[model samples]
Target: MESVALNPATLSGPVWVVAPHPDDEALGCGALLAALVAQGTEVWALLLTDGGFSHPGSRTYPRVRLAALRLEEWRRGLQVLGISPERSAALGLPDGALAAVPPEQVTAAVRRAFQLAPPALVLLPWQRDPHPDHRAAWEPVRAAWNTPVLGYSVWLTGRGAAADWPVAAEAQVLTFDVTPHRRTKAAAIAAHRSQLGLIQDDPSGFTLSAEMVDRALTGPELYFRPYGQSVD
Candidate 1:
């Protein structure tokens, strides 16, 4: 995959963002959402999972409780990005198990979101994001819709890329100058406090270090168009 440059500000109209978990949207495209909303672009978010599995072994926070909490956190996070609750859909799929869900169900959810707000472009998790849930969500949508897709990366660059990444010679990397919306992006990410070390009981629970948050804040929000498709 070769890399080409793109500007992210031009995205307009009804936009749908598909996130694997609660904070994936904040981590992946908070700035872009903020930029879009600021420009009066109507945007919708589709959260595929509850993100409850982060604290897998905690007796203090059961799966049900965690799921609810994560959903609330996700709502708050999207609010920070300026999306109203009515515009977002929490599909309630099991955390960490999207890959196992029925393909029809997943496509139904995608279709439902489209009915809610037909997307000019759909923002998806990068196909090879190194997260099973992210990959799971991407596959069904890729197969179901012919809409233009802009794949955002949360774990791919963090894990280091292999030769297959960026999608061969046709990849175009879209970059957005998020300086105006950086503060909101950080707040949206921080809204997921549980994922950022607030869960003290579960030693094994996932926690993003301050360093990681800082790193995400420093760069422009980016996405990859595998086939060099226009996001407009």
Candidate 2:
């Protein structure tokens, strides 16, 4: 897909990034977030899940404790991207179960978060992102605030099917180079210690592989702006 280079200075703010999980924002759009911040744009974050499901089998870090730690890690990552903790909100929704939640309920929660800091532009996972939670998060965020949205890619490169990608007629593909902000993006991703081998007890627990981290740091971050959308 041919993509135009995205210049952060051209984007308006305050921008709100809606992440389905704690590390998603960092993994997906950390460099863009950092660039926006450096451009003096106000960036806000809305985390959708409690992020406790990743290590469900660990007794040392139960769901409740794991959730709290993940929340803290999220805030730390946002801070690294120059977004203050006060500018972020977490819905505390159950991780890995968003698909089962009623859409109206999720939309209502997303609306409440928007009330805190109304966004000029919103960033969310692509509507057809590979992960179930990421895919499920799309509509509620769009319904909550009828604003301009740029869908960021999380698991798209590694896991997305052909249908998962936005077609040329559907979206304007844009890419932001991360080379300048590689270190900052890396640090933001590293803030999620639990997802990066901090949890030892659960053998089945999730841990970001070196290959995944390297992939994230090396490429240009892609954003898709849906065609034929009017932003009020």
In terms of lDDT, the best-performing candidate is: 2
Model 1 Cα displacement at 11 (Å)?
Answer: 1.3
Model 1 over residues 1-232: C-alpha lDDT tens digits? 3344455567766888988899988988898888888888999998888888999988888888989999999999999999989999988898888989997889987787778877888999888888888878877876656678889878766764684256456567767666778899999999998898778889988998777687678766668886646776
Question: Would you list the C-alpha lDDT of every candidate in the order shown?
Answer: 0.83, 0.92
Q: After best superposition, candidate 1 residue 151: deviation in angstroms? A: 0.2
Clashing pairs in 2: none
Residues 124-219 of candidate 2: C-alpha lDDT, one tens digit per residue: 999998999998999988999878999999899888989999987999898989999999999999999999999999999999989889989997
| Error in Å for residue 121 of model 1 | 0.5
Clashes of 1: 2
Segments in model 1 whose C-alpha atoms lie over 4 Å from true places? 1-5
**Candidate 1: lDDT over CA atoms?**
0.83
